[model samples]
Target: MSLPLTAGETRLIVAAADAFFPPDGPIPRSGSEAGCVQWFERYLALSDRRQRLLIRLMLAFVQLAPLLLGPERRRFTRQSAPARIAFLARASKSRIYFLRVVFLSLRAMMTMAYLSDEIVANAIGMKADTDPFGLGGQPPLERMVPPPTPQASGVRLKGGGPAVEPGLGDVG
Candidate 1:
């Protein structure tokens, strides 16, 4: 629900995030429970139309990955916990090059969101607000998706400037 994606897409993303970073032993809070969905919502809210579409396509592919596996046609969101885990493990290590990329991308996204949680970050030695600027309170997506560079009055509003490292560009 937090994600800007469609209902089904949001469900799929939540399911995927939970599967990717499920609780083990003492680590409480699955990825979705740790605010991964909300993280993704902020991220997508800043993405351009094309980027959002590509992300949705990747999510769709991940949702349908079971079909690519075998006769198990159940969508990713509907699968049991164990089955979802197995699918994610297999997809991430898949021999199919693009499948590996897609699955890895999903895993990375979930991991980033999961690590953004203060509890997990502290546990893992990542300071949440160590920065003097209080950047830790800002969504990571804000840096990843900066505001567009200023354009001329009559410009057609083309692409933004080149990609940048986080917090590197000056908005002013």
Candidate 2:
């Protein structure tokens, strides 16, 4: 299935991803070169309508945010790399919680798409750890750390009071 994003929207996504995960050092390629936009398109195609709409709205907001918050009133994709990075830095710390959330969400999406690429993963040695059929020297489940004992920590109720266990606390 095709993504619902427009050409401009797609460009915005690519620009944002490129700014967040620049093709520097170990990256070897820009987010656009690494196929971040295509990854996002595939993700959106599989997502629910509401999720797709939310992501689209976030992209629109990011594209237009530079005009409102930037020193120069330009679209985000039109800005220079440094300018784009500055705009994102400011947006990530905005007093508006929703704006911060949107920035973080976009950053996460871009980072995930970039890092999850087979080339990137292999370069980072993650590909070396995979044993799909458990044929490798995997640790036994019993060697794993046990779950924390709930009783060791004080359990608090939703309203911030300590949880009163039945029969453990004084009852009428």
Candidate 3:
């Protein structure tokens, strides 16, 4: 297994999938599915080997899917969106093409996860409690985690000025 994802990454993916695919709902979800996570794990392993191949596989998958499904007006292939998803999932599970397919699938999942929350949050006009990009302060937790000490937190580290300009010294 690959190194565990950071809590923030997990939170982001979860939130996105929840927003994108409601429980007992029609739309497809990412990372929330048991297989999606497994797909990501497998892909991450492959990425550790050949990163560029990931991109190639994704492009190939998209271009080949429609043709492979044939122009039949069947239930699966009739609708383009879901069919593409199903096809990709199945391909990602293929042992022979597992590396390539997994890479594409994970990349797609991550992309979807990165966007879902923001899109829903915007559609409903709800402001995000935390930055979606995970660049800001931590989201709320059950209990407060203590802040690091000045020394450990890099408060006293010199050779540079404060990260932000100090406002007029409040010393009265």
Candidate 4:
């Protein structure tokens, strides 16, 4: 699949995934080893416009954050593995709520993509396709939607929305 972001964005996300999923514990596969980059690309494509924009902005901010916060002035992807790990560690413990939120959100996004992989999900003993509520088993009913408000009238009817399945909407 064609990646929409710049090369630097791609590398930075890969770097983040590496830091977030280092091979130090119960997890058997590294994020990259689990094909996190491809998963993230699919995640981005399926996101609504606003979600995609927010994720892209988070990636851009995190890519440059090492320069401002790290001991050395370097882009995130250019930093060594230890440096990348330290960067995320510091961001996670940052006193500033905004910094913590940014890094944590990025971490969640990457983790979601990583575990969606078939091998990883099975290794972790998770039934990735379990949708207990059955909400998405069928197409939404015509009468299920409430009357759209004046401001949000067009949002619900948009076609090609996010995947309707319960897991790994990575088919994109």
Error of 1 at 14 (Å): 1.7
lDDT digits (tens) for residues 71-154 of candidate 1: 467888888878998887887787899989998888888888889888887777877457777566777788678778785434
Candidate models: Cα lDDT each: 0.78, 0.82, 0.46, 0.80
Give the per-residue lDDT of model 4 (tens digit) for 1-172: 3348778777987788878887664788888788878877888888888888898889998989888887868988989989998988899999989899998899888888788878888887988456676666655684487667573322433376633443434365
| Residue pairs with backbone atoms closer than 3 Å in model 1 (clashes) | none
Per residue, candidate 2 scores C-alpha lDDT tens digits across 36-144 of: 8888888899998898889888999999988987696899999998899998998888998988998999999998888778887777766544666665664667446
Model 4 ranges with Cα > 4 A deviation: 1-3, 23-25, 134-172
What total of clashing residue pairs does each candidate reach? 0, 0, 0, 0
TM-scores for every predicted model: 0.69, 0.72, 0.29, 0.72
Clashing pairs in 2: none
Candidate 2 C-alpha RMSD relative to the actual structure:
7.5
